[model samples]
Target chain A: MQAGKPILYSYFRSSCSWRVRIALALKSIDYEMVTVNLIKDGGQQFSEEFQALNPMKQVPALKIDGITIGQSLAIIEYLEETRPTPRLLPQDPKKRAHVRMISDLIASGIQPLQNLSVLKQVGQEKQLSWAQQVISSGFNALERILQSTAGKYCVGDEVSMADLCLVPQVANADRYKVDLTPYPTISRINKSLLTLEAFQVSHPCRQPDTPPELRA
Target chain B: MQAGKPILYSYFRSSCSWRVRIALALKSIDYEMVTVNLIKDGGQQFSEEFQALNPMKQVPALKIDGITIGQSLAIIEYLEETRPTPRLLPQDPKKRAHVRMISDLIASGIQPLQNLSVLKQVGQEKQLSWAQQVISSGFNALERILQSTAGKYCVGDEVSMADLCLVPQVANADRYKVDLTPYPTISRINKSLLTLEAFQVSHPCRQPDTPPELRA
Candidate 1:
């Protein structure tokens, strides 16, 4: 491990960054936050300095164990490998696969399609409907999967990585005004996960860069 | 383990499916391939029968150990856990993080943005340019990352999960006519990875459903 507290490059409203925040809190790992404003100064993530840290030019990059890891799931996996307390992935291979499937369903399948960069290309006139359509389609599948997988949380009651992915994405859905009534399972799981300290403390509304008006 | 051979729900041309195919080949695992033509019959993946297996309605779902695993990365992770030999993920924590970072850089960052479904929404007129732009921009970042991390392979000489992701995305790049010259590091690594039998046999051109005109 590194000698000092690890640092996290983050954007308050980024669902990807929020996923990492929840993981860091869940593992009880204290870290410094360096906010990379995704909107201001024409997206600070594109800045040369930030680009050096993450060539992908995205936030939620963690400086830990003397190395910087980008990608929320990768950082969380590293944390799980090194920390192993209050495990975010189940032990049984089959159960772990389920957690990962749900996580990727959100992380890769849904989140990427509706993120800021894609939305920028989608244009202002179409962004709302585009995000709504994307989120609803993904939620349709997620709802069915969660029907069989949920037990107070996504993938049983463990509050695994899937929960980390779920809560932030649901936040995005809310931002885009996607009707959640049709996705009862997703809505129920998000509601239950919101009550946890990890999810509460790591929420976008509670982050350092969260605007005063948006802060909880 | 299950009494019978595992089954892979796949489409020949889906990069995501090709990813799982490469992993299965590397692990030397015996599995049955059930082709789900993504285009035929208004997209077979959307069929109720297929949705029952993978609520996400995506190819590359694996039925292994008596449970259905969706998402290529999730399936690959499961195979790595159970098979272990000729490991797809490195054992070192930091190295593993790098492998995952690269894998996701392509899988989530690059692939989903230009996928057939996304392109369908992008429309036939804009599909080519749209795919070119998405792939080129992603490759710009990936090329920079690979400049430092790569050595014969994406992360050192070993063929980790990152290589599995790189080769398939490079194939997609080829299909889209994205100039490979700008990304020498990625091109070189991909060129080396292509020589392996696992990559050749699992290639989109050689799959069971590969059209006669497109077959190598």
Candidate 2:
């Protein structure tokens, strides 16, 4: 990154941002952190400057070597591609598909349903418990898939892209009071992953921009 | 396809299932459509047999060449990897990541929030308008993304995985009465994509498995 380190526009509690953070750290790529508080004065992400960076006005947008990118799964894949030294995806096509599948399972299926914005919407018009129930069902489904597919990580023994996606969502789920017992495999994988330096350094609680109220 | 074509466990109205169907048709790979009704008898997708194939018990599960894969994004990607003749993803990593980002924006970001399950949760407990608002806001964000990035297709000229994801989700947004006028780019892209043989043939209304009552 001769042009300079990638700049990540992120918020501490944003699971999507956390996924990208883990990926950058895993690849050992140097990058500057640009905090975008999601809850301050109607979201810093919606600021004109940030919106230009990500028109979607969401966290986890990256400006890498002058090019800006968004979406956690895509950002992680980009890192895996550009920094191929310590690979985050398997080389085999089938294995790569499996890895992508696990990542999508979380990125597409589970995480979105329980995102902060969605829950805020639920709380406004629907009941908080109702949103939690919807989130729990998503988690239950995730746990079931992880049971057969996971081994130390989301896909297999390797620390693939799936694990990066999995850990943060699991962290968010626990905060919502989700029971981890039903998803033993997911819980086990989370346990193994939390021990790693990549995940440890990327924890939301450690972020400089995390809200004081939510800090553990 | 030696085992009498792959069995696609799908729901006619499912956007996720529709994605895989389009991919299958694009490749000219034949598949047996096995309807798993999402609304009948508390969702047939939750049945023991279906759960055996997909622990998540969601439609658009593919039983391909002896192996079953769940999640539409995963299934389409698996096909892309396994059969590379007509590539769905670009060769360049940055471009591939761009395609995946657009796809992920729909798959993970937009589609999940407005799923039938989510709406059902809202209807079962909350007001109808509440659900519509959630769907509308998500679509609005999507429209913003489409406005800047989309060309004749989602990511410039080619028909890629993002197009497959875009059409189906747009269909769902229409079902919820979300207006298309605000999203001119999305509407324009949808119009062009609709003309394609793959999208036309794979349309839910054109599907043989679609119940007469649900046919548009």
Candidate 3:
């Protein structure tokens, strides 16, 4: 916990949490991580205390100097604005929109479909299949966009907000055993992103609170 | 389609389609809307012709001059960039983030759960229930944000991209029969948004390809 920084209520294995973590690290912002063991005892997200922090009952609810902000993408953007030294977004409007489009593609198009809560609703076998289908579908789109847009990172050579969004979701895709053979651009970007110390430190396995079963 | 504008492969009832329609209208950019009936002939989005436009086989694919762009959010941002008039996002970075947070709340957070395709995967009753649940959950979060942020629109009165995103999703929430009694702020903002000509022109009911069954 860094003094005067915000408080993040996050679960180690949560992709949403990982997104915020990567963003914070990329911006070199410091904050306290409050582990809300999401899978423990029927999910901590549903607990009354955590629920108060985020009515949506989701991971990665940030409380900064008494103001609580939910949603991973939102939180990252907030950080980007409040701390703009290592810019996560492009200064150019068109470029920013491109970054946002990629971010939304992952956040809306891919992540929700493979979310653990949604997957649990599908049967175990079907869940795996569903995860693969959604990931492949979303990654194929990402691959195409990357072919023209991806530089050293998702949008360009710079480590922008899009990279913050992509790395964790790509990690989730790997967890489901989805084959990336169809999306070489995405696979290459994923490989490139992993080398970043910011991304490396934010991996779920490295988080202090990640459960043993999910620490792949 | 405008003389030099893109060709949009859209379906009448797809929220994704509605999103792009509103963006085109907001930017005052003209485009040809080619109706690909999502439900007819086992969904036109899955047709080989549409597949050629979008390998992912999704509605709201755009043929810009020649290049194709899939995903509603991406397509909308592309238009905002390529057009760049009547700016869809706020100029201030923090305010823009706030706008996108709200947009994502609808675009990523709510729409996916209530989409026709996702609903089709589950049966009717479950579909209705999931639709209601996701809408209520999303709307509640939105209401809270609106209370803090709204002046005349979602992000401090200016008609930003957030309003464009919200109006259509709120329409879907109403279609799903999600009770709006609990979301007074969202209900109020939505009512305000409906008064806008841009929203009115893009409404699903007003579309030429809208099926009789879905019309109000």
Candidate 4:
């Protein structure tokens, strides 16, 4: 096992990186954060050193167990395996699948569509509308799914990987100015989740790298 | 277990649906295909009946064990759990995590950005370039990751979940004309994967619902 404290190569504003940061805090894994400014120097994540850690050149690459793991969900899975305390996924097969379904809906279905890279590609004129449409479509599904699966959280009372992924994507949705009025369950869950210390401290604004003006 | 063949609610052209189709074939699980015709009836997936099966209103929702599972990867995971004979994920934790990393890079990183809904929203003009850029960026990392993780397949010779996720994504890349020459390993692996009968049968062109003219 890697002896040193785990290091997270991340940026404050990246929703993908935020998912990892929340997960690390949820699992209570102490790790050092090395910010990779996604905007500065045409993206610090493109640097050779960072690329070596994560060839994807994406942030939230965790250095642990003498190995570097990229992909926020993948890193969270590794952490879950190594540190099972306060589990991030449900034990039941169906519930676990349910949790993953919601997580994937956000991670793959929502987040990628409205990501900064995508927004930039769409340009300023259409970016907001484009992102809102994507997030709105996803939130519609999320609200319906939560009708049966949710109870104080995305999936029943306990926090699963779904919650970790949920809060960040919702945060992004807010940034994209997507109306949450149509998604009562999602808004309720987001409100409840943000009240917790784990979710509180991991918010993008509270991160060490968050810009002063953006800080809450 | 519920009797009869499992039902796959899918559309032939969906790359995400193709992933599950390949996985079901790989595991030798008999599943009946119910074509959803993503292009017709203003997209049948958005219909209330379809939404009941999958709140996300996405294709490749599987009906098995008396429960409908949405999300292609989540469906695959459920299938992996119910039928473990032909393992889709690696046995080792690290290797499994590695396999999942590549899967997410495609599933979450690339696929969603170029999804049909997103494409329609981006408008006809910029769609092709938008998709190509996203695929190109993802392929750059996939190529690098495969350098170490690949050996005859995406993870040391065995056809893990990574390959299943890869083949379909690469298919989308080809459709968008992403220019595969820059990524040798991805092309090589895609070539190897396509050679398998399971992959062949699960191909979009070979699906039951594929238009006759589009059939391979």
User: What lDDT would candidate 1 get against the real structure?
Assistant: 0.92
Q: Candidate 4: lDDT of A86?
A: 90
Query: What is candidate 1's lDDT per residue for A1-216, written digit by digit as tens?
Result: 579999999998999999999998988999999999999989999988999999899988999989999989999999999999989999989889999999999999999999999999889999999999999999999999989888989988888999999999999999999999999899988998898899999988988889999988
Per-candidate TM vs. native? 0.98, 0.93, 0.87, 0.96
Docking class of 3: acceptable
For candidate 2, the TM-score is: 0.93
Model 1 misplacement above 4 A: none
If you assessed candidate 1 against the hidden native complex, which CAPRI class would it receive? Answer: high
Local distance difference test, candidate 3: 0.80
lDDT of 4 by residue, A104-175 (tens): 998888887887777787889988888888889889888988999998899889988999998988888888
Top-down lDDT ranking: 1, 4, 2, 3
* CAPRI class assigned to model 4: medium
Candidate 1 per-residue C-alpha lDDT over B35-153 given as tens digits, one digit per residue, 9 for 90 to 100: 99999999999999999999888998999888999999999999999999999888899999999999888888999999999999988998999999999999999999888788899
TM-score of chain A of each: 0.98, 0.93, 0.94, 0.97
User: List-wise, what DockQ does each model earn?
Assistant: 0.89, 0.62, 0.44, 0.78
lDDT of 3 by residue, B88-177 (tens): 877876677778677777877788877876778767768888888878888877887788778888888788878878888877887888
TM-score of chain B of 1: 0.98
Clashing pairs for predicted structure model 4, backbone only: none
The superposed Cα distance between candidate 3 and the true structure at residue A158, in angstroms, equals: 3.3
